[model samples]
Target: MPAERQTETIDGHEVSLSKPDKVMYPDAGYTKADVVGYYRRIAPIILPHLRDRPVTRIRYPNGTGTRPFYEKNAPAGTPDWVRLATLSTPGSSKGRDTADFPVVEDTATLVWLANLAALELHTTQWMIGDDGETRRPDRLVADLDPGEHTGIEDCVEVALLLRERLASDGLTAYAKSSGKKGLHICCPISGEQSDGDVSAYAKALAKELEVERPELVTANMLKKERDGKIFIDWSQNNAAKTTVAPYSLRGLGVPTVSAPMTWDEVEAVRELRFTPDEVFERVDEGGDLWEPMLERGPKVPEVEAPKRRKRAARPRS
Candidate 1:
């Protein structure tokens, strides 16, 4: 039997969890309490990836597989103790010039999000600096997604190509499942490069891969050309774009996690899907595989900016 509601002190803050036994993952029978427990246990590892990042949460209030909402602004009634980052979104469609997004700094905050059924936590490549503004992107990502008639195996092959290409450029690539039908190859980068520079570098690499293996890979985003190919989505490195934070859960009617993997695991992976229990077991055997991504490294290789074509002179009137 589970309590209908209860209060627990986490990191010096009291959080009230209600309907602990309510199933959040109806397929897996995972309840709200279970979600809270997972975040509590995974906090130490997950927080590093989340710290200083403004999270955009995908909330499934009624439970996974149900109608969900994407929450960018900090929800009303957020605890005063939780840190908020106010970002200026000029020309915004939401009709607000600024958004108060929550930054998870401690276990209590994570638990609070879990209580809200925020299963998917997405974040940008950059972190908020001490000055309370977004810093230069410190990470670059190549999101390799398999298209129709393709699957994990195709993604793995493309990832291997990426690993080799990155190594040749003196970059170390880290692998992680997208918790869906894709893989994300991340590299720690020196924060010296501008966000646009980093994104350009990623775009260059993706184009290079596409050239080398045209059959297995495609850098284009067109759906018609994606079938039977791996789409290397370099745009995820853009300053405004968000990728699923490592260790966050996916609401695919199951309790799958976006888990990090070693190069060895990536090389030999038959299936990229990993449930919460499997992730815990892997963590126990091998510490946080994503820890290395926090370190500063060399800047991404410079890319040649695309040359602008000259406009034709207007005909003499």
Candidate 2:
């Protein structure tokens, strides 16, 4: 055995590993090499979804990359299925090694990886409840965010209202924090639907809410017009737009903003009463609520014809 290899247990799984060189993987026996190995092993399962997607590096508070495990000159035997998210940094500055991984594929996968990564890293700083499962989201997620506002309570309220509306339509929806300042509400839908179809559905839903509560929601793409209301941000479903990765930490230095919650809890916390510190404490206390939610699929409504809208009167010619 290599002198650096050490023995340890993770979630009760006994394994031998080396010490981590970076602070990102702080568990005693983990290393940047181990992180790379984990990705390589899971590459076949992960790459099909990740390849070709551009990845963003998560930076430390000091504006340094939190280098995770990835190789620049991946060996020939390295499966083409595995692709590096970005370049790697060699050493640490403040006695902390850094590492980076590929950008997450989507919001759902992001959550999945975040939970798993948290477990793997043994940070105790993050937690996912026992309820979180591996089931894929049936509903599409459209994240509307105004980059400036850090008070997420308003966004949470919007998501709850939207969830209520969708439920009234017989469609089930789920919500989670983006791990930043916004909220993400995922509705169960057939992935078979085209982007245009999904976008149209989202727009209709947003318009319905706008008409009902004109004081709060705005579907306008123009920032100048959004004012204090939440933008419906249907563009998130657009092929080019990206939502925060599920488990990836964001902001200046904290772990990613997106955290999963039960629909009931989502409604309860609509007031955004909890601080990130509170969220971290709760996560440690209760664990993730998403696993169980995965078992229960959304109650999708029967397909119906799109409702027609009346055209606005044109000015006299």
Candidate 3:
């Protein structure tokens, strides 16, 4: 029998969905149709974050329980209606110089991706300019990843400290769940600073936090160093890197979304993970919590590197 196929007109664009009944999330029993529907409903709010950014998708063609692969370039057979961006990715492990990445500018493109089982949509800190070139970073992110024996509560503690630290520099911070096991603190910038400048500021801030609370936070990227603390991953601000886009679904055991949070919720830190249905309800009740990051804001302030206390050398016997 021929594979079942269906077409839907979204935003005046017709998109085809294959295997709409195929289960993408085995644990949650969510099908390809469910994924496409979620993206269609979420497009109104998520488009801003994805509009001009080149998306990197993590595809699970065999369902979330099976192997997954990262797709940076627009896959073969991509619809011509889908917007494309030719980006220069220097030092890419794949050894490619330039890649044609997909830019999700509308609901149809998003639905297309969902049909491919692209559960996770990741984006860089920079945006594509009107000339189709990558621009300076307009936002900064600090990913609070928990280590062994640490959890969301630990990330919340670090996030609050980061909020205060960023406030001291005159920048407002927003909080969100990583949709997996971490928390993301983001702030909008004026789009005037280079990726290096923004990354330096983020690194400096993370280092400062590490110094302020050595036992609770670690700026070091080494997993061993994060045994009992939240690792402040400021490297995600690099131009070449991509963080999971807010409202994107994760390919975890269950269907969880990268949901934005209010400071009060962050403070409470009880329920950080949210399912797709719950996220839709959240949008109905609270609107977009990540909307504040869409506005133009101040530049990232230059931060002085905090001096680390030197470790005492052990005398050889």
Candidate RMSDs in Å, in order, are: 1.3, 11.6, 4.7
Give the per-residue Cα lDDT of candidate 1 at 286: 96
Model 3: what TM-score?
0.93
Off by over 4 Å in 2: 1-138, 144-151, 268-288, 292-317
- Ranking of all predicted structures according to TM-score, beginning with the best and ending with the worst: 1, 3, 2
Worst 10 residues of 2 by lDDT: 119-128
Model 2: lDDT equals 0.47
Clashes of each: 0, 33, 0
Which of 1 and 3 is ahead in TM-score?
1
| Model 1 vs. true fold: TM | 0.97
lDDT of each: 0.90, 0.47, 0.91
Tens digits of lDDT, candidate 1, 35-91: 998999999999999988999999999898689988889988999999999997667
What tens digits encode model 3's per-residue C-alpha lDDT throughout 1-317?
54699788887888888998889899988988899889989999999999899999999998999999999988899988999999887887789998999999998999999999999999988889877665688899999999999877888889999999999888999999999888999999889988888889999888888998999999999988999999999999888899999999999878999999999999987777899999999999999999989987899887555589999999999
Candidate 2, TM-score vs. the true structure?
0.53
Clashing pairs for model 1 are: none
Considering every candidate listed, which one attains the maximal TM-score?
A: 1
Per residue, candidate 2 scores C-alpha lDDT tens digits across 1-317 of 33565544433333444433433333233334433343433333333333334343332211213434322222233222333333223453323233333433333332223222322211100111233211222346756564344245667668878888877876677666665456777765654444555666778788878788676788888877677778777666643234543333443232333566676676566443233345556556766544433333433433456779999999998
